[model samples]
Target: MSKDLEIGKKIKTIRKEKRLSQSKVVEKLIQKDINMSRETLSKIENNNRSISAIELKAISEVLNMEIGDFFDEEEPEDLVTFFRKRNFSKESLKEISKFQDMVRILLNHEKIYKGE
Candidate 1:
């Protein structure tokens, strides 16, 4: 598949995996001023339209994914790179890293159970 289509598919898959509806996802983006409609989301998921970087970034935040996650599906995100995306205080980073590590462990366990 084309890169655009691949990215779109990844977006759709992640959204579904999170059990999120298109309208719900769009609503989240709206809070970030993305101003996307459900139809736009459909077009994006179907690869009939393209997404801007800002839109993708906001989408990532709403989806609780790293921005790089969109461009590199199937790759594990580094905790440091993940933290750098947001401007948290140093003390916050330490706490966040611990939380993130716990989440990663759970995610990895799920992936293993799913035989991925």
Candidate 2:
């Protein structure tokens, strides 16, 4: 499949996963100053048209994802999303960040200890 088609499939998958309709996405896009018709979205989903970076950014955010996720496989999880998925509260997430930092420090210490 073409890159554009692959990206369109990814978008469609995310939309379905989130239980969002194309009209709902269009409404959200309006909030981001992206004025696109449902037909335009259909074209995008069909990969009959290309998406601009601005529109992609707006759509990705509306889909609650980073725009880069559309292009990259194995995209790194955003910390906020990681914590939210685990049902972490904001305060708890900040604490988790501390713990994550400690883990990195420990890993670095081990690397030094191993002289690698």
lDDT of 2 by residue, 1-116 (tens): 67788888888899989999999999999988999998899889888888888888889999999887888676887565798898988898888888888888999999999999
Backbone clash numbers for all candidates listed = 0, 0
Indicate the residue-level lDDT of 74 in model 2. Answer: 65
Error of 1 at 92 (Å): 54
Identify the runs in model 2 with alpha carbons over 4 angstroms from their true place.
74-116
Candidate 1 per-residue lDDT over residues 43-72, each given as its tens digit = 999999988888889989999999888775
Which residue pairs clash within candidate 2?
Answer: none
Clashing pairs in 1: none
Worst 10 residues of 2 by lDDT: 72-81
The ten-residue window of minimal lDDT in model 1 covers 72-81
On lDDT, the leading prediction is 1
